[model samples]
Target: MTLKHTILLFTILIALPMVSQDTSSSVSFWNILKSHCGKAYEGSLALPEEDESFGGKKLVMHVRACSENEIKIPFYVGDDKSRTWILTMNDGILTLKHDHRHEDGTEDDINFYGGTASNAGKKEIQFFPADVRTQQMIPDAATNVWWITLDDKTFTYNLKRLGTERIFKVVMDLTKPIALPEAPWGWVD
Candidate 1:
């Protein structure tokens, strides 16, 4: 009823939304990726390389599975559906892992290799450094670093070998989503 109490109440009401917005933006990178669930995007290789495995192939990524704690995006190269990028959030830390599988619904020997974000990234970008599992699986990849950027128009995945000259980058147009591709290898449904 008093002017001072009324002013304080108004200030608290105005500040509540700002606080929630700030928390959401801190995890916006993950939420942005999740927003594309059930949708697929086409992408192209951004780096020129001699590796023919990904050459002349239509690359597609489907935001196939999503949950509060994790998301699994299957990246398809032409007809090969053996790759899935898994993103997980645990106690504010975001982690990335590559899930590779065979056609017979079996896991590949060189699978589940990736890293965790070193800090709280921005709303549009997050970086991951190679984890211990990656180092043990591929010694040369010990210095690998991967980052993903998401925005209203584009979603880009990038990689770098800290001590080497190897780099891989893929940019997907988020503005133009494509048809969903087949289930990734090892996916039962």
Candidate 2:
């Protein structure tokens, strides 16, 4: 191939990726969650300072979107069969409801409702406990229902939007530290 032709082709290849990157379709909150419907992510629940006295132990969250409106977060403490939690996120609110079933589907904990915010990523929402019934909750970190925002082209999940490109860090209190109870679902040579 001629040098000029090769150079032109290389430029196109590099520019093509940039063009695609700059023209990504705007992703919506609902759509983003929908795409992660059947996927589970291993995450740790942030713990407080050792001397803070929160006493929340480590755990592993089995986060899965059971349906379009429901995300089920099941967790186990260490490798014990005794301590477990079944947190349900319906619509946009979360409740620490108990699962009366074994991992194989046999009954266990008492079910109850709890308070959570419409946007879990909001700083103000994380600052204080919010009651769903009362019209009082954290203000919007940004416009729309997006729990996350794009800042300088980077995805910022937990933020309090003051304005464009301005955000406050969300201070989330840990109910428990979600540790890896087992190895990630898949790994093989």
Candidate 3:
């Protein structure tokens, strides 16, 4: 082969792996969730106090819709199927948003409230502080910070409102794959 062609081929070979390599820990975290696509898990609140909205209810999370840049997981609290967690990767940054809907599939006024990762967190965890939009939507939640931890055994979703007593935590067992739940409200499939 010609020297020019050989040099070009060598360059492509050297850059191929780098192109496919994870750009950041956020991507690694995304890959971890993507791996669990189409699966569902059961969870329970870890906080000592029982929450009225979540207490005494069967908690289930279905990792339903997944794509190259987004994953939508429907969170079922007993018969209430009004919440879904939407995670999207944009320009190497991961953003988490909550989609709340009514029984008729209508968007809730307090929907899409979440934040983007402040930095590239660890492969197993990422933290999202309340964004400007979230602050505007829920002034009381301005100090809110949400995070998720995913590993082989457990996946936990947590929230803590800074300078307040409000906190929510739910831990799902990853090892036990439960039966898939129906799609959340406002979800087509």
Candidate 4:
């Protein structure tokens, strides 16, 4: 081979491993959740004190929509379809937001309240503290901390309202996915 061709081939070989390493090391919790796209799971309240609104109701979570940058999971509490948990990844950070809607396809007054991950969390868990929007939307929740845990068998959504006796948690069985439910409120199809 000519000297110029040999140099170009060597340069390509040296750069390929770097590119692969970057991709492998960059996998985050977002990627793990995205893998279960199009699946739905049933979960139960993990905390002793349940919110009256969600108590005695069937709780379901459907990883309904997924893309490179976002995953929208509709959380169904009985027949109510007004809640969707949206997780978005941008510039290596992940943010969680709650999208609430009314039956008539109108946005709820208390909506889009969540926070971003503070650091590079593990592929199995992430913690999001209350952001400014969350604080403004609910003053008592200013000190709230939300977390999600994912594993081979289960996925858990948890919350703790700091400085108070408030906690909410739901653990979903990931191993056995259920049939998909209807679209969430305000969503077509």
- Model 2, 1-189: lDDT tens per residue? 999999999998877754222111222333443343333333333322232222244334444435645544444444433322233444444333333345444444332223343344431222112234311223332231223332311222232233465332212222332332342222111
Alpha-carbon runs more than 4 Å astray in model 1: 1-26
Higher-lDDT candidate of 3 and 4 = 3
Per-residue C-alpha lDDT of model 4 across residues 1-189, encoded as one tens digit per residue: 999999999999887855322222125567778899999999988885557887778999999999989999999999999999999887677888999999987999999999998775777888889999999999998999999999899999999999999889999999999999999999998
**Top model number, TM-score:** 3
Best by lDDT: 3
Candidate 1 vs 2: which has more TM-score: 1
Per-residue accuracy of model 3 over 1-189 as CA lDDT, tens digit each: 999999999998987865443447988888998999999999998874668988888999999999999999999999999999999998888999999999999999999999999777889999999999999999999999999999999999999999999899999999999988877887776
- TM-score of each candidate structure, all chains considered together: 0.85, 0.34, 0.87, 0.84
Which candidate would rank higher by TM-score, 2 or 4?
Answer: 4
Better of 2 and 3 by lDDT: 3
What's the true lDDT of residue 67 in model 2?
61
Score candidate 4 by lDDT: 0.88
Instruction: Give me candidate 3's TM-score against the actual structure.
Output: 0.87
How much is 25 displaced in model 1, in angstroms? 5.1
Q: Scored by Cα lDDT, where does model 1 land?
A: 0.88
C-alpha lDDT of all candidate models, in order: 0.88, 0.35, 0.91, 0.88
